[model samples]
Target: GAALRTLTEATTPALARRVAALVQEAVRLRPETAGQVAGCVDRRLEQGPTARPVLLPLVTGLLDGGPEQVRAALATVLAAAGTPASRPLRRELLESLLDRERDPAVLDAVLHAAAAQGDADMDRSGGGDMGRSGAGDPVEAPYRREDEIRGLVHRTGLLLVRTPEGATLLDRGLADLGRHVPGFAARMARWLTEAPDDWAGMVGPGARRTIENLAGVRVPA
Candidate 1:
């Protein structure tokens, strides 16, 4: 725990990565230390966005090369840190992980972390004057934001469909994202239909059926 705490104090990215490696080694040598390490990391992450810069290198280092348990733990830690103020950083970290992670458990944790961001426009619930027009009418800001999120979901789905394990988690994560962003599932269904060659052959029957059902797409007999 104490060793992991030193990650926050690391002055450079190199140093942070080194500290992260040490923590990983410690956890490996003393498996029981995993819980305590997670606790220490959680406390620092709870500091919110301010702690992101300091933690990013450490977290990235771990996610990049740590053991499965360590990677999963770090992903869960990022998910728990998900808040309106920290969503961007959390999304960035999780999405990056999505690109390279192959372990089913780690991917599951990353997907859950990404889904835990809730709605894309959630941060706008505070009613800021930033997106208003000269006539005090709402502009296309929210719709545009939703569109961006839809695109992100599409890209992420494409990545997830590349492997059977990832495909198994795809529908559930899409459902979670759809709960926050209306029409997301249907939109993704349309995307899949438009490009059948991209994912149709990659995912198994079970995942394809689940995705179709979730999106309300009919599979003709």
Candidate 2:
């Protein structure tokens, strides 16, 4: 409570940043403070650009080393702060974390965060096509977004499938991605089917079935 009060009353970006850093340290020392600290940070972010630069590093630091609760909280905060200007940074932050984060709960948060930001970005840009260029040419934004999502899926899928929860989270994330990105699920299914036999065999039956259901494909018995 004191932490949030301090953040709310902060007179400047520097002050807010300092308070946010202290809150991060508090979470480090007392994991139970994570929810409060995360709430404060989320509110700070609502102040917009000024608070974002200050809190971005704080969130990154927490995600890097804080306890599971803190990481998940910050991940959800990022998901909620899905403004167009923050999309690239948010995606990058989640992508970097997914590469090294192994805890299922944390992975769940990160995957959902990524999906939320991706969908928000697409929606703000006017759905899958992301609007057309002035010269009647297709805009490159959606293509870039597609590339970003493709990289995320390809990189995280194999690693996440190693555990049941990770596999399930990955499936759900893909389903979310498919809702906004045209044909993403079908493309992912193709990727899965085309993988080497060894790699395909590594995916458990439950994981495969979940993926198939979302992707609208049925593997033959």
Candidate 3:
């Protein structure tokens, strides 16, 4: 009984983490853990979004585990995490899944995850849903600010993008200007460090830059 008690004490934490891990990882094994995984997911959902981030790694792990119902589970988990604030983590999940998952339907969902964030490829997002076409008539010679932000974001990073407004606030140009100006990334980083009480305006620096570079003006020299 002593040995058994020791084992239980030692394993309790590890087993708990494992149970959590297996919920997503079990998808890789496929079929074998199907029922158990479903139960785990149900329990996780019962706990709600508070636990969604913890589920990220497992869903990502199963993306490589081969053809299985895990895709359904992953889709459910991701859809749950699809709030505006979760966009960054969601983008990472999509890219990682793209590199792993071979199933076409699964891949399609991955693409939508990537595409839903317009600034992901360009500075864009209408509530994290892909809206209509680029915000300008392509026929114009001089591109508009939104067009520019879109172009710069595409050039900078394709994983996260955001829409920028006004001529004075160009992110890509600002990044470039900062390169010449120095302490820019540092200062900007510091300003953001203040952590405004409002997260509705909160966006990671990279995503913000994607939008910032896409600002609506010819960047000044």
Candidate 4:
């Protein structure tokens, strides 16, 4: 812990700036529970769209690192944004990572992000992104909240239902070119090469068949 002390500080205006962006991955150096993980990713999502560029780079690293890391990272992102940004961001982030992503783990997260959104929208199993309110509020994690859960779930769920304006960007953003991730062209090949039907296989048995049907994979029967 002593070693991480200096690194975690992120003090000073200069260090604080990139510190938020830079320290994201260090937390992923190991496994963290969904809540702990959420705080890590949400900090950036709580930032601004300007942070999108930085967030994308962090995704690239997580994607390149390993499957588990990528999954947790994506989960943190979804839990943090929940409805405020999860739905549309899901499509955009997936399109971004998938377009340039080659690693099965990374690609899986992109697809899984869609799945998380699907699960959250339907309020399945009474699980979804936890409350956006500060953690430790007792009513956090959506599941624990009895009074407001239904309303919160409905509002957040609606966003995921919409196709969003940018879902099709992958088809047209021909210029997004995923130059950020490693093995760019080959990664694009891996994603494009696969049948969209396969994506359904990645996230099967959810709220809407849209995910199962439109995704580049086949959903379980």
C-alpha lDDT score of every prediction, in listed order: 0.60, 0.60, 0.39, 0.38
**Cα lDDT tens digits for candidate 4, 41-156:** 45545554654655555444444443465354564365222544333453355445444444333333333333233335335324445444454443244333321322222222
- Judging by TM-score against the true structure, name the best candidate: 2
* lDDT by residue (tens digit), candidate 3, 1-221: 23322322233332544444444443454545543453344344444455455545444445555345656445434433233345445445544654555444443333333223223333233223344446452321212422432332232222222333311223334355334433333333333334333212324454345333434222111
Residue 51's lDDT in candidate 1: 70
Better of 1 and 4 by TM-score: 1
lDDT of 2 by residue, 1-221 (tens): 67454653453545544554566667667877677776766665555565566666666666666778887877676544355445455655565666668887776665555445455665556664566756686655765765565555555566677787787776666666556545555655665666545345344555556557767886532
Off by over 4 Å in 2: 1-21, 24-53, 79-81, 95-100, 125-128, 132-140, 158-187, 190-203, 219-221
TM-score per candidate, in order?
0.58, 0.61, 0.32, 0.37
Model 3 ranges off by over 4 Å: 1-17, 24-53, 72-81, 111-221
Clashing pairs in 4: 196-215, 196-216, 196-217, 197-216, 197-217, 197-218, 198-216, 198-217, 199-216, 199-217
- lDDT, model 3, position 61: 45
TM-score winner, 1 or 2: 2
For every candidate in turn, the CA RMSD to the true structure comes to: 5.9, 5.3, 17.0, 14.2
